[model samples]
Target chain A: MASDRTASQPESSRGYAPASGPESERGAGPRAGSVQCTSRAAPAIGAPGHQAGAGPALHDLDQATIVARAQNGDVSAFEWLLSAHEGGVFRLALRMLGDRAEAEDIVQETFIAARRSLPDLAAPQSFIPWLYRVATNKCFNLLRSRRRHPAHPDAFDDGSVPAGSHDAFAWGEADPRHQGDTCGGLCQDPALRYEAEAQMRALTGLLQAVPAGPRACWLLRDVHEFSYTEIATIVHLPESTVRGRIARARRILAEGMQSWR
Target chain B: MAMNGGKPRLGCGRLIDDVWASIDQPATIHERSCRDCQSARAALDHLEAVTRSMRERDRGDAAQRPSSRVREAIMAVARAEVRRSRRVPLATTPLGTIDISEQALNDLIRFAASTLPGVRARRCTVLRSPTPQSSPGGPSSAGVVDGGDVRITLTVALSSQVRIPATMTLLRERVGTIVQAQTAITMQQIDIGVEDLYDA
Candidate 1:
């Protein structure tokens, strides 16, 4: 959305709301992240701090008081805390478990665990990593179980051959010159598009093949951009162990990705 | 290489796993110039591309979000957790003062902000600016303003189509008018923020 001081157009200037939704629907998050502002201006209720601009930085204001209230049996405060963290917890579970149904179950389990342990939580600053740590464990448990039950559904893969076994560019006898370019996703040429998609399928297989420990480290580092220390906290490992695991995961992934070249 | 399940593929040699895994490691001259390392590097690049591509697709899939039932269950638990009575005093009068809960006031603000053309007011923080004599750190309540000007700070997601300036003006006016009219609380500063643009 355009920022402050954008030219004020008359209502008439707003043409019939565009024919359809915005072309890109990326990063549309869950409603739980919505802030319920309670200003300290009133003696009866005060959530504290009315930030002029809105962003993650603004939302980062401590919820120590709210968390304290929740721990002391304030349902309202608990609700706000849950809402703020639920979507993120769910997303983490989805990515780690790779199954929507399983992720939902883990989300439920994570909240239950969080609620039980919240009173013991040291402070609001650690709330996010603490919550993530809970969800990550739930996802880890599910992954281990899925490994045992070979028949379990793997949303991670769908019968595509790994690119390491064949030429990724050779999709259904496709073009030889179609070098996979990461110039934003889909290619204009149908053959190149097919090749690109096949390569993605192969990579997905390799990702699923990664053991849970290294996979979490690699994903938290690469995709979620968690710091090594933060990751260690969430995974309950030494900082050095986290680094070594991430490096090892990368090495394994590099070998598996070789065919994409 | 043909598609064969049992056969091991001829893949890149050892540099990627042993040397490149720990990215902090500087590559030797041979490792940098070797045919296998170059191919390994490209493969690593492709690995990143694949993850990025997956995230993009996953982000677009809004349907994958948790169900409404989950939200309802959470709200149910939260509401059930509030055992104590809740009330907000609007004003004092000769007969009696009308009390409105904090949630009710916030609801009014949300309602006012939503009525504006193509705007969803999210995270509305209504703070009463401290009086000139009072310390800045003074605690302020939701409805018990104690005769100080009210400052409304909120984040809103704007529709992609509307003109931001006009909408912002409408938002400030609507919020101020509603808060004043509903509870006799006059607004001093209305801080409106545009957080994100949505398809509406």
Candidate 2:
């Protein structure tokens, strides 16, 4: 039954959208050609900054006022907050996952989880760490999956590695001559690319060596500059334990990373 | 080696450990004067600096990549999240207005809510409109009126194991206190909408 739909559809248009629908007979619409399946922007539904008939940034209007509004199921307030932190959250996911695509997945998962457990949140103003914890968990889960399968490294001229072992060659072989011409181009910034690849490798190495509980604690406290109490709250570790893990993680990072530099 | 898992004893070691937790904090006087400790501290400091520097460098570099694929992936995730939240009745909760980032507000709300006893589930959010029409003026004139009046809400469910009304009142008081204490908001009102009542 599904095969007939596939037979009717042109071979050229096969990707996410068609595959996503339930197996049905009406999949016979003329397929759009080479539609870049990757454009992920949500259709501007409610409006640019608002969604679902909710307001925007009303959460910040006044703490009490916004809280009262949000409690009434105002999604605009939630979205306004999402818009404000999307960049930072993306960066956090990117660094944690060490892959842009995976980082994006983590960002999406974090918000979804937040939305699921959002009502559980007691304070609107303190959502950053919780969001990060969700993002970190999602990235780690993806990384675990990727590590199991392993794939060919991306051939970016600027020297990024899907896997860390190949980074040195990628960084060293990039051409300086072309760098001038390709300044704004994605693969052109050799020096910057080299550093990014190297740093990810270093972070990867450091994280692997440290224990799990400690690694998150350390990253939140040191690299990300979260407080001890905050780290404790995020990781579900005791404040003293958070302190200890951070200390131990730091000592390990200091010892292990010195060799890389 | 992990610390002796017993209660942490306060001493130079404990103090040293705290100082080491943050990279920007200076090495303590005791750490600087003791030759062996100083040497170890130096090693740790050097390693931390290089690793942090490498990450900083990587973040800047990754931004220049031409893969709109990466951007697409992020947007995909963002859109999926929005859709999922819309679909799940349990996912929708009124979180009050918070001037912080979405992530930040979520974390704070989670922390504050979880700490208070008897609270089962909660969601924090700022009030906003789907289409934020600018006021007659622009941002300057856009007050609460422009954005449907700013609000942050936290809708909570009492533990199925606890008394609903008592828990709700307790939550309202505690949450109100925490919000006012941690953030600069005189909460207009914590709705305390009790979604469920659990039988003991």
Candidate 3:
């Protein structure tokens, strides 16, 4: 009778990573200045703004079903939902806040808020956009509070991850064509690559100089590939305003880096 | 700011913004060589690099995710939401009552079960049959382990090459022996769930 025990299964519930921290581990990242894509930094999610191309497909994980089940008060279902979206939420918060602990707090708060607000959420299909809305609000609120009691001496600190420690694209996740194609023929010299990386690192602060509205739009477009409609939904601006912000953000980024380029 | 606003278009005559919108493909070969276009391209690359680097760091750094303390907090909430008993009676003596945490007992079972040859357990849970009064919000029971009977359910990752029936039989016996000898708890039922077969 004991030879073949029925296989016991796990609950498949997803757990939250901590937000409160000594915040020391993340202190090693692209602080105010340096940044790179070590094996640790690159997620298999492909590029944020770059359209997913011929790389490995990320379509296998179906989140819609998870969301539906979570709405029914299913704990395991909620775990599946958390597992699917937490990475993006954390990343967006980290970029906008520029402080790992604050980002962690935002992420934890986002999930908690999501848990509280799920009953009113009507559209499961629009969960990602809706999640973005909740997280963006939290980020904006934090930014506003920071303004009332500022900590830093300058806008961009440049005290991030040290240079040359981590590889920018170590895992070959970059489209072969991205590094090897048109741009490479012109800018592939070892020195040019080094300088370009340095200039990019330095440009981190300037990104903060971008007006908040356009910065949000730019990040939504460039960092997350959110469309005009998705962006308008989150920012509560008209579609026209969304388009303008994206354009303005691009222009500002290009202008800010004019000296570096 | 107007430095590139009036500059000549790239060899293809497309504005730098247009080229950047379709970064992978430039209408003209000018994308690689034009002064204004290169700046815009570098800006796009810089953003991409930031996203990439941050992601890698988050995945690499254990701190990026919720710490174990956070995990417990969430689990605590989950425990409240679900109606699962959290404690198991280990013994009863003049020193109040001795009990083992449901999670602690599971961990004990997991360590024992996975110690066998070709048997690696993932979620080893020592479950108790819920009584009529008990509402199962969580899995396993607080008083069930000391009740001297448990329904142990675990997902085992087995070596595909092993003799399934024989290996599992020996594993059940070995793990059961370990649980009884060390914890002195009776094995009500040891259920082995084969979650996946691994080549290694």
Candidate 4:
């Protein structure tokens, strides 16, 4: 049943490298002293005196420039590249781990690995998927290790998996009691509807119950709109398998969400 | 700043958690003074705050406002990246030519100058054109000539201990090779500006 859906079909919502010390850059000759008014050093938004001149327009670059510079030990270039893509990457990790800090750590580890292997990046434009692959592997390893040592419990582990109990992990059912606190509304008025809070909690709970792989697959495919080929390349999975996982993940999510009615 | 620790204790994680939980919410002073505990508390506080805010926002219809300043900052980071990747000059002078777009040229000059024997220091910049001075010789009398196309110029700050003539020759030869090979820019002249002599 899971294998029937394509990876591109919206299933539902889903979703390091070592980082250099935040202050390193490589250059020729007397390195230009740190740019005092550099953008990274300042708050881009909501900062005082933030006129148009304060911000320079920066077009997003494909991975090739980043890989080349990083290979040559240009730490700053690599860092900028990291910052540019971190939001999407971080969001994916957060969706999977349900822990922001752990997701951050995974991102850091992913980059460290990427930096070490930058020389092997044949095409810079192809680096994003490659990077995601590396990061996913690291996260999976962390998950696997946590499984082996039960003491280090992930957000997903709630004693059900170990006992071979499947139903114990409920999905998409929000606690009416904490509905006010766990909602995920984008622009609905809080005072307008008390029930929306309950809906949000249920959505979050359902998202939390998704196993990491399917969860990742669904988020990448549905929320992020990555192509099946791209998802496959990143996850190191067969395209068909990616499709199946997403389908399964979505069915579970949809079924879990059905209770909201 | 090292904490007191003799023998290592096993199950330290559990012990720490237990002790941490037992503390009646710490006074502001106590929390602020301890780095480790403070970090933990801050993490928890941040998580709680973020989650709470997210929930509150989810309950409302407030459009997520794009912070112009933050957007600008992000743009700025991207711009700095562009500048970093380009061949650009830190500063320009009247005598030297600076091309901010060529990393190859910068690397070549820096590498060549560093290799010059006894040349302990180096820096490079482009010279700005000087304003014309009125003299009897009309156009020639005006000192300003558009020298931008003449050559790729480099100003190397050298050490006083080195033979200026010999070092200059060696620098010209080596820098010329590196620049041509890396950037494909043939140089008509490599103007070596001796900014300051480094003490041995």
Lowest lDDT block of 10, candidate 4 chain A: A35-44
**Each model's DockQ score:** 0.11, 0.05, 0.08, 0.02
Stretches of candidate 4 exceeding 4 Å from the true structure: A1-63, A152-188, A191-201, B1-200
Chain A TM per candidate, in order of listing: 0.57, 0.50, 0.60, 0.61
TM-score, one value per model: 0.50, 0.44, 0.47, 0.43
Candidate 2: lDDT of A254?
Answer: 50
lDDT of 3 by residue, A167-232 (tens): 121111233334422221135577755654455455556666655556676666665656667778
Question: Which of the CAPRI classes, incorrect, acceptable, medium or high, describes model 1?
Answer: incorrect
Q: What does the TM-score come to for chain B in model 2? A: 0.39
Q: What is the DockQ of candidate 1?
A: 0.11
lDDT (Cα, tens digit) per residue for candidate 3, span B106-153:
556655755665554444555657565456686433445545656666
Among residues 3 or more apart in sequence or in different chains, the pairs in candidate 1 whose N, CA or C atoms overlap within 3 Å are: A38-A47, A40-B140, A41-B140, A41-B141, A42-B140, A42-B141, A43-B141
Whole-model alpha-carbon lDDT for candidate 1: 0.54
Q: What is the interface RMSD of each candidate, in Å?
A: 15.5, 22.0, 21.0, 19.3
Cα-based lDDT at residue A146, candidate 4: 80
Best candidate (score: DockQ): 1
Off by over 4 Å in 3: A1-61, A150-200, A258-261, B1-19, B28-68, B82-200
- Candidate 3 at residue B131, lDDT? 67
- The positional error of residue B44 in candidate 1, measured at the CA in angstroms, is 1.3
Scored by Cα lDDT, where does model 3 land?
Answer: 0.51
